[model samples]
Target: MEKTQILPRATEILPVMTAVMDAVDEESGKGQRDEATGPLFSENEPAAEYVTIGCSLKGGYRLTGVIAENTGESSIFIATNGQTERVAKVYHRYKKPKEEIIERIKSIRSPYVIPILEEGEIAGRFFEILPYYKNSDLLKATPLDAAFVAQVVVPQVNAALKAIHQAGIIHRDIKPNNLFFSDDRNSVIVGDFGISSILDDRQSVRLTTASRTLGYSAPETAQGFVSTESDYYSFGVSLLHLITGHDPFLGMTDQQILKVTLTDKLHIPSTVDNTIAQLIRGLTVKEREDRWGYDEVERWCEGQPVPVKENANRVKNIRPYVFNGEEIMELDKLALALAGKWDEAMKHFARGYISEHLLQIGQDLASTAADYEEETNREFGFFKLLYLLNPKAPLCWRGEFFTDLVRLGERVRECLPEINRDYADLLESGALLHFLRTKQLDPAVVDAFARLKERCRTDRNEAYYKMAFLLTGSNLMKWRGQLFDSVDALVGYLHANREGDIDAMAEELVGSKYFYAWLEHLGYGSILKQWRALPYGR
Candidate 1:
């Protein structure tokens, strides 16, 4: 091994070229030869204006002048064209053909992978060229700063693996050094497909004569089981590295790293969130059967919600006082009525007539209209305000209010779209009636449910599905038996656009313990069974 140095002009050339030239010069018995015979640049070429940095690694190569050096093991450099930058990885000569690995990597078409440029010998040393990236590895950064690692990197990496596996290629080496970040810092590119194995036409595997980095290699690889799943295990290990900020076998010696990987003693970081930690452990399991396939891993990543910080102590207390006067009065009236002080609440409601408080109350209420709870209110006080204002207000406002509340509940059944009722005001007033009667479901609730169903159909928004399920589940519980007809109608409305994880929805309903009876009444037993059978065991 030779000591690494940063040369002034070395940044101009490919990283692997620099490393190979430096290694040969350091290791060769003949030290600095005349400039004419030196490996870098043509003998007659003038020492270019670019600076060259060099370094030596524990392995066979000495790296001379980094093409691009930031915080990771790989080097990036500009291609001869000067437009696109390429990465250069110079590994020890291996028995497996390099061209085969190059071809396999080139076949993958994911944005997460760095495409190979060209591969050949330069100055008697073999090197591979990859597209140069401008982002730092999550390995060297804190997990807190790399929240995108879990949200973006892991998902994209898993998706890339699925594509690679589909192409029948196994990346025997999957680790932090192989993962690169794109210029924007929002995307990642997996590089260095060295040690990758391409399966033959028959699905049964053939062992490739190659060695992987000690800490990141899978156990079965040691036993010669070189399939796509082995790469999955490596991906799992890479994820662990990102989360824990240390290798799984970090403190262990080389022999120990190899030994513990063969045994079950290797432990994942328990301090990690349980969902992610479990994913890590499952991926690194010695038994191939226990390991998740790339698609399954992708699904798991999809299912995981962003991890919420647990300790509220660090959170800054910054509540904004956002209530308007009308909203405050409405809330006070509701609170008073709920507290059995209906007479005082009614008095406050009537105060608008004498004190000309309607305008102020209306403004205040309008201010609080955005509050989720206030938007749900549907009582007589709300209607009374609307009725008083309808004759003088803008037609759009009055019409919207009317249309939103009609047929809101059984109590306002008379206000529904009958022969002569104003349709807009009827809907609004009905919704308001429903809100007043239930106090749980807001007037906006039904619209939200309708929008959720549309989004599920058109956009497959999972959040919408979850929200709609929650709202319907709550309403079903409140209306149970008494509002069976209405609940059934609402269920039909919700069920029409149901998509994704029905079992999970059932589990959520069951977990709440509020909608179980309603769900049963809705003939959901078989639905629940099928839901439970889905991948998430919903």
Candidate 2:
């Protein structure tokens, strides 16, 4: 929290330490992959059973190589039966797939869906093995022409969805990573139903909050409502990615993507084929009630006319407000434009250009706009108006976008070197207090913010950093990118890595009252004393 311990210096210490650690690991042969041994196949032995890396499983499978580590639901590894390679998804400690859903999925077999070859518990942690394709996934074969996507991809995935949905399951994870292709690329198989859930009578259920992939997930998924329509939305986004080889929401923060998904329309480029664009529009509709499903996709595939309920949620403005040379008729689109081009929108608002159209929507909005026009802090007032226009939109201040307090803290951390003045200003101005109140947060939460704002006014940088930590709900001590969960762990690490002015490093950390308060809150007073008692003077 000290200004002297800026990101440049703090970040500098870790790479050297990390290099030393890596060298030690290399010399010791630690964390290295073991080469596979044994023939790929034998005429006498069946292909379903074998071993490679000395470790064996309950089934005839053996892990050969790692494909991906620490995914949302599991770690993906390559397993072999000597002759054939298979994908093994080792589930995270508490993220096993529902047995009922898995059984249902297994019963409804389709060529478009990869079957679960084997499943069992290893040390009480669940894992499933499926056929592995050497060609990887649809992602690697993307930027495909419209003809291939429409003629080949659509029908195959549509069949997969029909079977999955008929079995009363919603495959919540439906992005490119889950869609695999045959060697010929003619057949696309949907796999990895790790976070899938059974649908209720209403065809919707609240499921897995932490695992939904951003940009691919439907807007309603943000509220934990998973439905068949949500899957279709993801499929549509996947189609977009296939056509462009670029995620439209790439480089955007999760909160920003959520805002775009909830409030604005998905803009299919005019350059895209008209038919493909129509399909994307129908599938990516913000309103779940109006979004395309199996029937519409089938109809589209059959060269039949599909009725799309476009602009179902658009506000009927008496007269359109023009901005960025486009007529903005919808409240959501207007909010999007205002946030997207904030400075220009602010200038327009100052001239009372938007107030008249706002009056048509609601007197309250018009009045709010009028007040904001004269407010001392135009940025705060304008962003508040933007929020009022679109309640689902993420909170925005000076071009930075974040959904809640946690993301704001993360943004603060990213810019710790030369912290933004707007952050301090916004904290002290009661704007966040008002914003939080609108969300109907607990009274205690509002009271905490009020108290924090008072503290922020004193030592601007130190107090702001404290507020950032509070917002993030993080106690992890970060050295460069390395994280330590507790004072004991951090202190122990420092002790082990004590070289080159360890006292100076200890002295710098102890100087921050912010660090003291954090350690005290975690009840690490004894550990703090021990840390200070190190040959270093405190």
Candidate 3:
């Protein structure tokens, strides 16, 4: 929570991380025609079934090298001889485990737990032969039905968690990839204890808060707080994902994910059984102490009624400060309105429109900005700090507007000769911004855009208001030997028809013939495309 530790806002959004290994190609255990015992390994390598059968685990079953990677550290191969089938997980060069914990896992008895058949340390690394259920894993069974999750998945996984916890261990990572179906019924069993830890396993590998595939991780863990309750939170999330097809935090940055998990109320589909919904609610509350422990899960699985109450440990919502002047609160909506893409957001401003706060903030920030000899990221920090200070502040604008202001201002200071061309987009982008800021258009701005003839394009809603104004309602102006006739007749035509039919609007528009299915003309489509870089949640 330290200010120095804070980075850009979550709405800045996080870039996507490197993609995970393609499990699809390797799921069939056929090696996907890859070289098994070579001095090299590739990303496209597939899973093989009958290889690596020669590895003896402390001198026991003959393991096949079905998946022999000459360049990687891990390998998987199935061992079967007419009756028994088991998966041999070979970790080469870099795997560590406490023999005491592995022994405890073997001693714990549970049908929903993947039994460790045998394990051994050949070199510095170790390998374990686990009971392999050839049926399927949860990763393969996406979008499971709600009934299946409540009756089959949740109970079985709860049983597994009970057994693991009883053995004083915690499955730090609980996700689809770590769950497999039992060979007997449609029941699921917990597997992959590779990253798991025993209660006293202090020498264990440090499980980072931001580890890859964190959607199922608890919010506290994402912020570097870890506990058994964190595991319960993750299990709850995994269950939700099974019932619903995707992670709730999908496509979000780490920061954004934290914000959502911490503040937003999670949506449990109404179609799900109310009991199941209540169970999930109990498990996923933000506070660790509020989450359901294995004891509660056991009681539910046993058909005993458990009372659901408001968690005393759950954090209370703190509403953002309300500013007396309403204008500041609605500046974000106004920005969008001014951009001409105002229809969708208008409902939010809710007709109680105000702008005194924005006009004041704009004036103050503009004055402060003038004091800077050179434009820098700090110029924008003022706005961001204002947003943080006033929790009630409307998003105020997509992050793009402030950056565009600085960029355009720099162009003015550069004092480059205006290129003689018609509808040159780059110069026009800046010129249009200047007009929006101060209604009077500068001569240099107009001359810089004097045409050799091409359409200027930008979709930034902030930039569009004036351009939209010129397109929709104004008559053509022959200024300095250039024509502004395209779509310029829109407003007059609308008044003549008295109907604001967008389809009709599209037809009357001129710069380009293309139109969107939304019925908006594409004359300004190219202009909007330029704003795609801005991290607006939508």
Candidate 4:
């Protein structure tokens, strides 16, 4: 069944509404109030103000009409200056744009990249204004012939990618929706750098670990690794959709997509032209090292012959292992299958079927299998086996993917009060501890897990939270749903909101002393003292 459209369409404000705003206040009081009021006035503020309802930005762009609402990261709206219209992106409260990345993007001078006209904070939220392209995004302009994409779209977007790559920015989210047509409607320009990552920066901040758009996301991204090649992988997926006139993974659930795409070869339909197929295949190679990048793509655009490198490491399933009624050739696929069917997987192991097949595949895998066989808890053994099978796959327990140790800690925090069974098993069963030891992570991180493991046995809920706090380290702490990277950030949030409930929650948390002690341990004692002295704390 098709999804019902429950919301109204995003539309421009009618002539009637603007006339009313014009009558309300002629000058509209630009920047007269304190900075705390809202978005700062744009230097190019129009003389006649019409938008009295929506907020205005410091860049002098006033949001005139809704273009897209609640887009997870930001709300898209039409901003105006009376004489011209522009696109405004009002970021969600928790999903603020990284200023460093925004600054880099602003410095880029490329016709292939959509320009950022203005950017600043308004009402404690970040916003960006861009020239409204008359032509809509590439998602709406699909079913184009392979010829046009190869000749026009590829060259333009590749150029944009080249510019951003040189700027040390990895456009993590590159798909049809984020690619827009130029004003002339002849070329494509990349937009929406909100989720892009900046390389080589030790102090870089990421909003979330798994930020890639599924289906288009590179396989390595599923395991929490992304590079310039990752962006090219997404570009390839977008090209597939444009040329094929449909999503390659359409109608498949997210899990189904991940299972197949991550483990199997991308099946470019044989019906596709050989030239276009080669380009798509090159860009979407499963191995990032073998995947085509700027140099290969640029040469292809220049009409020079570009050879697509095959993924030499992709397993050939010389002696396939049958599982869950399917022939599994690769270790990664076997790991996914076993994780999916726990009971069946255990049965296979008990029968010595899995180990037998592993021995056939390789001695190393067979050795890992032998070690897991000795685990008292079969479920925990299964988890260990899965990890051994594919260490690069997200450390999955039960069914969910906790992309990394930090993400796993976040999950534990999210499930406290009634801890997640998978989390409990991983911790209490010593599977996580085993993972920590084998992975050889930072000793401090390992020590944090040891503490977490002991706490799991004691039934102290605070210990679980403490483990989360410790594991998070310099990363943002997921607390009661809100995220805070430091005591100052938490204090700043409390000061700004100041609701009765918020203050009460703050008082309760500070009274517990767990949060206070954690902050102190991190050497934020002076900051904690001031916070406690405030009315929000005990």
User: Which is superior by TM-score, 1 or 3?
Assistant: 3
Show pairs that collide, candidate 4.
40-58, 42-59, 42-60
Candidate 3 lDDT, 111-170, residue by residue in tens = 898888877755445678887777768867778887788789888888888888777787
The digit string of per-residue lDDT tens for model 1 on 445-525 reads 556644444544444333222332332332233322223222224333234434555434434434542243344333444
lDDT of 2: 0.70
Looking at candidate 4, the ten consecutive residues that score lowest on lDDT are 1-10
Q: Name the top lDDT candidate.
A: 2
Q: What is the lDDT of candidate 3?
A: 0.49
What are the runs in model 3 whose C-alpha is more than 4 Å off?
1-60, 65-73, 81-83, 122-124, 200-212, 302-538
Pairs that clash in candidate 2: 40-82
> Which is the leading candidate under TM-score?
4
The TM-score between candidate 4 and the true structure equals 0.76
Model 2 segments beyond 4 Å from truth? 1-81, 88-130, 142-173, 182-187, 191-228, 241-278, 294-306, 316-329, 347-353, 360-362, 371-378, 402-410, 416-475, 499-504, 513-538
Model 3: weakest 10-residue lDDT segment is: 12-21
TM for candidate 3 is 0.47
TM-score-wise, the better of 2 and 3 is 2
- Could you estimate the TM-score for every candidate? 0.42, 0.63, 0.47, 0.76
